[model samples]
Target: MGSQSSSFSLRIWRAARDMVVAWGRIGYLGAVVGVLLLSPSTYRGHALRPILRRMYRDTAPILLGFTLLAALICLVITRIVVVTALSYGLSRYALEMVIRVLVLELIPLTAALFVAMRCTIPNATELALMRQSGEWAAREQRGEALIRAEVLPRVVAGLYASVTLAALSCVVALVTAYLGVYGFTWAGLPGYTRMFGQVFNPSVTLLFVLKTWLFGLAVAIIPVSTGLYARPTHHDIRPGGELSGLARMFAVLLLIELTSLMGNYY
Candidate 1:
């Protein structure tokens, strides 16, 4: 029994240590990428091609599908909110509620999750496979900085995809909210715009943009960092690296969302 207890304690310690190391690696990689992004030299010549290609690959294919889905969701949600408000005789605040709930919160979170599912997770898996199969090593032998040639582009592409999807979805939500609140008419445009301005004052607008960017950054960074540092040599530890990365990514996203809520409401 004592031996079993000691063994269990050892497992707990190792798990805690691994968690700390994983987060440390993520932070270090994020800082390195940020520095590279700010440097003008990082975008010269051969590097530019990969970034543009990645941006196109990540964004273009999914753009139409995602936008359609966003519009549908916005329409459904707006209808529900409007009907509920009217039922309660609180129709005056329905648009404000929709704008606050749908645009400020739900759309951005949905976009990040969508991009993570479609792009970043797959990218991370590919990176992990390359790392396991020694492709990264082979590239390093040829004097290529894998971080610059590979990781940076994927990170940038992920950020771009998340932001673009969220922005487009917010637009859809806003339009849908307007139409749902006022029907197919231009008469409510001024009042709608005024309500929008009130909900999205300068501070709230800044918080909204910052929150979206942070969501994009988290989506872009966490999985790739995990993939780049994955230890696939041990048979016992190899199988669930991607799963663990996904969990970590989700946790970070939740944390960012909670912080944004506090900033906006508290």
Candidate 2:
């Protein structure tokens, strides 16, 4: 029994140590990418092309479909909120609730997850495979800054995708909410604008923007970092690397969401 207890404690210690190490690596990679992103030299000539191509690849293909999906979701949820508020004699607060819930929260989170599934996860898996096959090391040995050439572009693309989708979806949600609440008319524009302004006061607007950027950063950084640092395994790389990256990204996203909630509400 004592031996078993000691073994279990050892396992727990190793797990905790590994978690800390993983997060440390992620932080270090993020800082490096952030510096690269800010450095003008990294954007010169050849590098700029890849970043632009990645941004277009990540954003263009799915924009219309994502916006339409967001609008449909916003419409359904707006109707539900409007109906519920009417039933409860709280119609005045319905628009604010819709804006708070859909625009500020749901749309951004949904956009991040969508981009992760569509682009980043697959990118990460490819990077992990490259890492495992020694391609990254070979490039490094050849005096190439693989982080700038390879990682930075993907990170930029992820950030662009998340922010673009969220911004567009928020617009769609607002329009849907207005139409749902006030029908197809212009009479409610002034009142709707007033409430929109109230819910998105300066502080809340800052928080919302910050939250969305953090979401983008998580969507950008976690998977790529995971892939860049993943260890080789005998089994297929996809399941392990992609699953771990997704889990880490989700955790960071959840933390950002919770912090935003606290800032906005408390």
Candidate 3:
């Protein structure tokens, strides 16, 4: 019994270690992804071009859908708040508030949740099914290919989608905020830029980029990788198998966001 207990403890430790390694490799994947996305195909010639082509193909529709939905939501919410404030004779402060809350906080968060809802679950389900069928291991000779190919793409894509949408949404919200507050005129544009520069300081901009990148990685990778953890070297499901992954996913996402927010604000 004592030896059995010792074996169980060792298994737990190894599982924990595997999770850490999984996430660490994910970090490396993220760096590669960032380079691929940022640099041009011309730099590396044809090698990365295929990746870029495939990435753009996968990304365009997702980005468009996300942008449309996000714009509609931000527009509706912005209009409602602006009208409410104008009704109360506080139109002057409405734009700033809307830009701050909607652009800074709600839009990014909404994009993350939206992508998680649309993308993450399907990724996990597909990976889980692949693991069940043993096709993943057969494909790359290394079981980790499921992660490199299937999971990592979505993780990287989610990061792109989140940051792209957030940055784009900021532009849209600011434009709408400008039109809503100051009438469409040359005079308003300069003041708008000034106000934007004030609100969007260096730290805030850096934090926004960092936070969204972290958010994107956490939301996408957590679900899929946690799903990976449930499967043993052998095929059959273990105890606490299914729900453990999902629970861990949400818990980690929440923790990451909370820590990012705390670190940024404090």
Candidate 4:
């Protein structure tokens, strides 16, 4: 019993240590972003263009599919909100309810998670392979151009995909909400705009912007940082390292979502 208890305590300590290391790597996003800002000069060399193009190709389909899914979800939720509000004789609040629920909260988070699943995991794997193969070391020896020509493109591409998906999904949800509430007409535009104004007051608007930006940053940042933590000489790269990074990334995402909810509702 004492040995079992000691083993359990050791496990807890290791888990805590890993969590601290993951949080420390979150600072890497700042450095990556700073490098990304200076990366445009590398565009003149044309080396980064293919990478950007490939990232776009990979991301566009995912964005389109996820946008369609978000639209379907928005339609279903809008219908339910409209029906429930009408059943309660509170039909007047249906649009506001959809805007607050779908637009402000769900869409951005959904987009972030979609992009993280689609983009971040593969990018993490690629980075891990590069690190393990000594390619990252070779690049470091070459110069900062490796970051500009290689790493920053992937980082920026992920950020772009996250932001684009969220913005598009939010627009789709708004349109679906409008059509669900009052089909095939602009007559309700005035009231809808008024409700939008009221629900998205300055504070709420700021929060939405901040939350979406954080979502994009999280999707772009976490996996790559964790993947880069791989030991260059480590051979067994299968189960433990990859899963640990993904788990930590999603945990950070959940934390961001909870923080947003608390800030807005609590």
What residue runs in model 3 are displaced by over 4 Å at the alpha carbon? 1-50, 87-89, 140-147, 232-246, 259-266
In order of appearance, the predictions have TM-scores of: 0.95, 0.96, 0.70, 0.85
Report the C-alpha lDDT of model 1 over 1-266, residue by residue, as the tens digit. Answer: 99999999999999999999999999999999999999998889877899999999999999999999988988898899889999999999888998999999999999999998898877887888888888889999999888988999999999999999999889988888888778899999999898888999998999999999999998999988887888886553332246778889889889988988998998
Quote the lDDT for 167 in model 4: 90
Considering summed lDDT, which 10 consecutive residues are worst modelled in model 2? 237-246
Q: Which of candidates 3 and 4 reaches a greater lDDT?
A: 4
Question: Candidate 2: which stretches are off by over 4 Å?
Answer: 239-242
Better of 1 and 4 by TM-score: 1
> Candidate 2 lDDT, tens digit per residue, 1-266?
99999999999999889788878988998999888878998778887998899899989999999999999999999999989999999998888999999998899999999998888877888888888888888988999988888888899999999999999999899999999988999999999998888899999999999998999999888888888888888777773256656778889999999999999999
Q: What is the C-alpha RMSD of each candidate to the true structure, in Å?
A: 1.8, 1.4, 5.4, 3.0
Off by over 4 Å in 1: 233-241
The residue-by-residue lDDT of candidate 3 on 32-65, one tens digit each, is 6556457564246444444455356545767777
lDDT comparing candidate 2 with the true structure: 0.89
How much does candidate 3 score in TM-score? 0.70
- The deviation in Å at residue 89 for candidate 3 is 4.7
What is candidate 4's lDDT per residue for 1-266, written digit by digit as tens?
99999999999999999778767776765576666677676566576675678568657788778988999999999999999999999988788988989998899998888887788757766877877777888988977465555556667777888888999999999899999888999999999988989988888888888888888877777776766576555556632246777777677778888887787788
How far residue 256's Cα lies from its native spot in candidate 4, in Å, is 2.2
